[model samples]
Target: MAWMSWTLPTAMFFITIAVILISMTAWQIISPCIERRGFLPLATTRGDRLFIGLLSSAFIHLAFVALTDVNIAVATALCAIWMIVLMRWG
Candidate 1:
């Protein structure tokens, strides 16, 4: 019954959007390097990389927010592992 907190969900929604925007902007700025490396870049007119990045960032932040509320150390480790998996498999 206690889990029905409106405030937490609202905060998470806003925070996720902010994180996605900031991350996407940063990705766009560094897209040239990403392109040179043969990865699809955010600056591409095709928009594939931008879309993927936004989606992945949303999940990443959501996971971080959920796990961090329980344990900071575990959340940090999870984030690192998530990043590695995304870079290797995505």
Candidate 2:
């Protein structure tokens, strides 16, 4: 089946996204977040950071694919680090 044809990396990517969404939902239900000014120029909440991080990560991955020979594993690792930083202190 088409849905069953995912490679390891494809499966991992979706699984990671699902886990992040589930955890974020639980965190919001447990203790809500307050917007704050971080290293970023503007104040943002968790959701904003997630959106920004993911958007930038997509561009980074596209750039890597279009301009370099770097492996996707490297891009994924960098994206993960970027997401963590933005979520914690963007």
Question: On residues 3-89, what C-alpha lDDT tens digit does candidate 1 reach at each position?
Answer: 856798689978976896687678768873343222444333323444564567567667767766665456556665755544544
Error of 2 at 83 (Å): 1.4
Task: Report lDDT (Cα) of residue 59, candidate 2.
Answer: 99
How much is 3 displaced in model 2, in angstroms? Answer: 7.8
Runs of candidate 1 with Cα error greater than 4 angstroms are: 1-6, 30-83
TM-score for candidate 1, please give it: 0.33
**In model 1, what is the error at residue 70, expressed in angstroms?**
15
Candidates' C-alpha lDDT: 0.58, 0.91
Which ten contiguous residues of candidate 2 have the minimum total lDDT? 1-10
As for candidate 2, its clashing pairs are none
- Candidate 1 local distance difference test against the native: 0.58
Clashing pairs in 1: none
